[model samples]
Target: MSVWFQSTGRKMNNSSEGQLDKICESLSQAELVAMIELQLSEVDMLQSMFPDPRELVVEDPSVLCDLRDFAEGRTLLLPPHLDLIINLNVGKGRLSMSANLPHHYPAVQPNIFVRSQTLNRDAQHRLNQELLGYLKMLQQGDLCIGPAVTWLQEKGETFFDDHPEEVTKSDANTMETKVIKFARLWIYSHHIYSKVKRKDILDLSREFDLTGFCLPGKPGIICVEGLSRNTEDWWHKVRSWNWQKILCKKLEENELKAEEDISKYRRFSVFEELGSENNIRVKSGGFHVDMGDVFKYLENHESGYVFKEYFGISGRAT
Candidate 1:
């Protein structure tokens, strides 16, 4: 790992044009490795505002509605341009959201309602009302879903509990477009309870993304349809036999453990901090290796909770 990182860095620093081609190339490789190896946690990804994926960003109401409209309530999808802030004085420690159609990304200044130096009575109340509306939507929003299942007892379609491993050549030839989108949720919370409030939450613990949450016992009731793609590729493997082998491959081999050097535990302190005495225990493979002052070594940094979920992705399932 040290050699690989050092080599990549050397190649980038030696470039004459100083162009980002080499650096970008390395990043692309790193990203692909991260996706396949790390299978990153969704819960932690949303701790900060993340720039929406270019392809996934939806600005049109129709697009958003068609994807997630469960009931009749039309909760407006806030544009990426809008920003939220907190005003402690006026709204009594509540959050205040303001918008700016600034010629730039944020044309207008962020008018916050709560803060140390910022406190306006009317503005705080207006923001409070708006937040209340969102809370209502979150609490009672109609649940729009895709494909159906007998679980909900609403007469839906059948779903696959596991992915298949093998397929026939004749069937593969009939395939149209090959694409399947998965889902991952970022739930912000420390423990489970009847009513979970925002301020009490720490952060999203885990994310059951895409097909990961589509299992029979999974907690996801969401939809992930192929936009312009056909459903043939998805349906073929649905009924194929020997599905358990494929599942074993995915679950065992493709475990999304957090990034940490097993031989030399650097981030192990996080385990103690989370109050994990037994569950967070590490099983060192006996053989050990260490790097003295290896600053260049970088594979993928991961949240400790992700490692904790290594064999327990089923916890989020119903």
Candidate 2:
């Protein structure tokens, strides 16, 4: 079946028409049309920027409705999922979320959640907080999934950089019973400016046989990826340091907790830009530390690192 639309001045394709009919069964045509138009506009905007617009996929909630009794929850099942393929300077990431409208949307808020592996409990709570903020600003009865997803994509890079996790965890029951667990430490410290403090972290990295990059500054980030046990040990040693004296301490203690497995990076070594003045260096068979232009030499000799898996998405993964 096809429907003629004066807006596009063309006959809608059979597949789209059928989709629209499915939505119309549960929602008023006016409301469904408005929702569909908003979604298509989002797709068009994404296609303009990305090589493959299909990466930004939106699922029809009506399909999920067939499997559940909505009356039990008294919620409108729309915007089942928004899957985004995010590419940033830090790395490639994916984010997915679900927004279910309450019986009285705009008056009663929608329940939204993050369904991405890249984010943990704290991160999910933070994202939901931001989504609620958007809800408050919107007019009563306004559809919200579009704006919430747009905000997520814009901020995804920071999310991944701050809370990067392994894309896949090994199963102990599988034939490959040897499971390698790793953890990523995003160290934020003001003491990094001091030569002594800088060396302390580098020394710890060598002692643990971990590989990661450090961007030295008053409040800089140290991205480390390595075995979970060693990473936890390295982290505790860092926590015990005299941070107050150096004026460099963790901003969020909870964010620094170790034991999480990092399944992404294949090997350990810091990746740095060749010309940076404060680039961390390796010496004595990658044991000692230098604070100069030595990454050029290491880059030539060190094996390149590989990302083992793509970022994980939530809901029906695209």
Top model number, TM-score: 2
TM-score of each: 0.16, 0.29
Each model's lDDT comes to 0.22, 0.44
What ranges in model 1 sit over 4 Å off? 1-171, 174-176, 182-184, 194-301, 304-318
Candidate 1 lDDT at 100 equals: 17
Model 1, 1-318: lDDT tens per residue?
001233234321222212322343344333323221211121123222224443122223353232232112233232122122211112222222221111111101111111122323223233334433433332121111100001112211111112223323443554434332221222212222212211111111111111211111112111111211111222221212111111111111111223322223222222111111322222243111121111111112222233223234322211
Query: Candidate 1 lDDT (Cα, whole model)?
Result: 0.22
Instruction: Pull out the clashing pairs in model 2.
Output: 166-263, 182-262, 190-218, 190-248
Q: Estimate the TM-score for candidate 2.
A: 0.29
Highest lDDT, which number?
Answer: 2
